[model samples]
Target chain A: MNDNPFSLWVYLSQSPLLWLTVTLVTYAATDAVSLKTRRHPLANPVLHSLWIIGLFLLLTNTSYTTYFAGAQFVHFLLGPATVALAVPLYENRTRVAAAVLPMLVALAVGSLTAIVSVVLLARAFGLPREIILSLAPKSVTAGVAMGVSESLHADPSLTAVSVILTGIMGAIIVTPLMNFAGITDFRGRGFAAGIAAHGIGTARAFQVDEVAGVFAGIAMSLNALVTSLLVPLAVTYLLR
Target chain B: MLEQIARVLLWLSLGEIAAKSGLWPLPAPVTGLILLYAELAIRGRLPDDLGILADRLLQFLGMLFVPAGVGVIAYLDVFKTEATPILAAVIGGTAITLFVTMVVVNRLGRTIAISREPGSERVEGAARDVNA
Candidate 1:
């Protein structure tokens, strides 16, 4: 199998564009399906695209490094995309200003809960110290979470995986869970999603409503800042 | 469009420089967002060109995360070994955070709403137009 010179898989795997195109096309198709299904939580395009891409890599025996070579182009946009969150935040400035106090309080408590719960639970399960440290910033965006993990001498790749799973879990269940809890306020819903899930959750909030999206953006940014500062200190103090 | 993107990239670069300089313990993108927000605040509105580009990028923001999210494949071994703790922490922790944050924010929002009026009603109407 490794010596198959004529194999299409080998050729495609060699091409950097393969993973890039696969990512974009799979996301577009999954997004369409999500729309057709009226954006049902289970029809989440990110989840679908992730599974599809993961399976593609597995079936082809393509290394993640190879896939990421092309996919980095898309990954590069995350920085700018995160900065672009300011547009919505600025657009909703008045509401943000009015709710600043509550947002700050929520950010404080939410950030704490996200960090503490993961650490406590991970410890209770007797996970390794590095794993617990990686889980500390799981609710932050991948880039920031990775940075935090690295600074804590934890595994960045593990942190990235934890962050994605945290986001997916929050995106899939937060809204319904909030609704059951009688929380219909877009601001609250969006804030909670951002605090719990970070970027993916903020994206999900955007899909639900603009106001929610705006607050989600704000929460995501604030959570990143708060988590980066607090996670290291908390890990040293509590875990040690 | 090119110019607008360049301007946004400039801000992002500035943010990266600032973060790298170690002046603030924040992510470059976040610092960039804060800089952008400050610019908007001082300018009173987003420049038409930049707003268009930013809106376009943000409209499909989820797509930007697909690449990184797919990195999960790299950690399949970790997942296989630590699946229970990882899943328990992520799922249970996120649920708890979501529930607690929503409850706290909802309560606080109600307190503010008593005096502020339901701004979301008007915002929802405007949001419909933009979303449409």
Candidate 2:
């Protein structure tokens, strides 16, 4: 056991894989805990999962890079995971065709809100051009967010955190908040989460109802398209 | 799991190609997705086995972020460098996006009632029917 790269002794000695192993295990377990706790919106699979993993990393004194090597395998899958979303959308094409107009309108509104409000407030607060660039695509998924960040000359890492935070927050608050606003329809609840939260919100929508999940998926994919175009263009032409 | 592994690798290669092409304005993964979707549309299914393959992948999608999440180390100091403004943008930006989505989507919901489709609102009623 002491010879294993991630064993307790090797871990204490700062094995590279130790931190990543612990991070993965912790999130996997925490996800279970959050799901078991009655599907609370606050459960936030990403938040709770990361919190659990971060604490473990801190306790072990293992650096983030050490863990990322092993975890990159999982990270690498995000692209394919996104591609897989096509299956469900295929299954729900009928619903998607029906709601295309409302979905498109919702996406345009959400993407604009993300860009305008962030830029206005960031400028009002006197943020640097770089931070403002990163903020431009914070509402989109990580894949698109990172792409927007790079094209606009912002820190992709910074964009990643903002995107993840938006996703987790959107996942937790969207449903009840939407119902409160009198949106009891699948298109509304799902699209809000999808356009706003991206993949994480889509996952949250899955637990609600199939209709919500379908629209959420479409909303997510379409928002990824629209936001990707809008964010980079804004930074290039408008913000500059 | 085996099929998923191969499929993912294929998708990654496809994504990389799209990203580097510079032919269109679209991002790589999205371009790959478009290609994949076109294939699916023409074929009328994403290779039957992909259904089960995708289900298993989605179940653990959260775990996949571990790599990117840990990369937060890369930015720990960016916080100190531009602490005040960065915090404002993240917190302020998130709040506005959330608020705007709620307002726009719900309003759009009333206009389109996008849930007019059968699948979205089928859960509760469907459950009761199953039980009965």
iRMS (Å) per candidate: 2.5, 3.8
Each candidate: what lDDT? 0.85, 0.69
lDDT of 1 at B61: 81
Q: What shift in Å separates residue B99 of candidate 2 from its native position after superposition? A: 3.9
- Shares of reference contacts reproduced by the candidates, in order, are 0.70, 0.47
Colliding pairs, model 2: A20-A67, A211-B120
Computed on C-alphas against the true complex, the DockQ of each candidate is 0.59, 0.43
Tens digits of lDDT, candidate 1, B50-103: 878777787778888888888886676876888987899889999999998988
Residue range A1-240, candidate 2, lDDT tens digits: 555666666644455465556656777777777668756677756777676666666786756766675566678777787777776777777767776776677788887777777777888887778777887788788877898798777888888877776677777777656655555655567777787778887877776666677777777777888888787666666565
Task: Assess the local accuracy of residue A229 in candidate 2 as a C-alpha lDDT between 0 and 100.
Answer: 78
Q: Tens-digit lDDT track for model 1 on A151-231?
A: 889998888888999988888997678657766678888999999999899888988888888989999999998998999
